[model samples]
Target: MADLVYYVAVTLDGYIADSDHKLDWLMAFPLGDDATPYDDFYRTVGAVIMGAETYSWILENSPEAWPYANVPAFIVTHRSLSIPEGKNITLVQGAASMVAAQARMAAKGKDVWLVGGGKTAALFAEADELQRLFITQIPVVIGAGIPLLPVSKVLNLKPVTQKVLKSGAVELVCDVVVG
Candidate 1:
């Protein structure tokens, strides 16, 4: 049994990416010692999951190589897209719970990482599949952009830990309270 963690970085305004869906704003900030925390978290992830938009962004940005080639990558999308050859990637369509179950199985004993694009994460949260949220709050504020979690329903979270990184980013880890 592995926990499905929505580990992501968000701006002060609660946006994950800017209005253009660009992470350039986020890339501008240096992680400094914060890199260690991310490195430590990444080590616990056995499988990665992301929405179609996130997958497309990665394809366009890092065309040369797949970043999560070592782990099983699952992309949830309704549209047809071609995956790079020799990459450990799978295109899946359907409900969030189904997709999450697949990722959990692939993760084995390790945790499943719910990689970005707010709608996807919201779907999992709505389905009661998401277990944990590890949010790194960047100091900058983006006026308008993709929200962190765009759920209409209220989801209670219990704080697990909080830390202020060297780069001025505040990391907050919480457990998603489920009924």
Candidate 2:
């Protein structure tokens, strides 16, 4: 089975994006030497699952083409959205378990990248569908913004690994404890 990994870059205060739902703060930082972390991770992803807002952000920001064109992408959204032509993207609405099952099948033994927007990741985490979390902690603190996981209940995580990047960013990997 493929592991559902919520691999994302977060602020020091645990925000994925600012209040405006923009990544301007994150984009300001330069990718220091050995910036291949994302490329390395991307090589292992076979499928992707993201929320509607995340999808919309990508569409608006990356107008030229879809970033994850090679992988099967699933967008969890209640609102209607259009998929770019020739892209392997699916718009779905349902329980996280159901959506995760589809993503897992599409993953074909590779990992499922949970391209998140907090709410969506929370759904998977709340449903116990998320397996791992890879958080790249950016140095800045956004004060207030979208949380890393906005679940009402507590979700335990076991640390797997930690690394400090050349850019003073920290990368922490953890396994979502299933109880």
The lDDT for every candidate, in the order shown, is 0.91, 0.92
Question: 87-155 in candidate 1: lDDT tens per residue?
Answer: 889999998888988998999899999997899999999999999999989999879999999997999
- For all candidates, what are the clash counts? 0, 0
Model 2, span 9-108: residue lDDT tens: 8999989999999888899987587554678899999999999999999999999989998999999999999988889999999888999999999999
- Shift in Å, residue 135, candidate 2: 0.4
TM-score of each: 0.96, 0.96
Runs in model 1 deviating more than 4 A are none
| TM-score of candidate 1 relative to the true fold | 0.96
Shift of residue 127 alpha carbon in model 2, Å? 0.1
